[model samples]
Target: MPLASDPIRALHSLLRSTLRITVTDGRIFLGAFVGTDKPMNILLTETEEFRLGPGENPNGRFVGQVMIPWKMITKIEAQESVVQTRNQLDRDVRAGYIM
Candidate 1:
């Protein structure tokens, strides 16, 4: 059986969506997905940073637009709607729904 492909398309589908990204240093960033490069570096607009542990701020600091190195990222999360879309895409690919 062939493996499902189109990872690039899946990443593109995440554009313009709100994402919660966690980095290696235990900081979380919430931002609007804007851009990415061949290296997988991410660019986000209307960004905010939330630090964990002591001195945690209830309201995240406004960071405007920022570029996050892909290597620094530990995890990325999207809203339920985006997740559903991704899941559907996976199912469709597995079912040979897309050519």
Candidate 2:
């Protein structure tokens, strides 16, 4: 699909960007936003899982790239969205979700 016409293609622009994703269970995942899908599922690389509350280390655990379901997501936080900023106009981002 052409970048001009592709939906969900903006996810590519976030490549290598840091993101903080919160799930329904109140756990937070901080990682690089790599991709997503039609259902709003997100793909994050170099992830860390954080539980809420102070005194709990923000950098508690590190995991590899994580694929989170749309239904499980409660929030997504990024410093900025490339799609919103419209930077890297020519970059092609691919969205992949297994299963």
- Per TM-score, the best of the predicted structures is 1
TM-score of each: 0.78, 0.66
Error of 2 at 75 (Å): 0.8
- lDDT (C-alpha, whole model) for all candidates: 0.85, 0.73
Candidate 1 Cα lDDT to native = 0.85
- Per-residue lDDT, model 1, residue 63, is 96
Instruction: Please list the residue runs of candidate 1 whose C-alpha ends up more than 4 Å from where it truly belongs after superposition.
Output: 1-4, 86-99
Query: What does candidate 1's lDDT look like per residue over 1-99, in tens digits?
Result: 111256676777778999999999999999999989999899999999999776688788999999999999999888977768777877787699886
* Most accurate candidate by lDDT: 1
Report how far residue 87 has shifted in candidate 1, in Å.
4.8
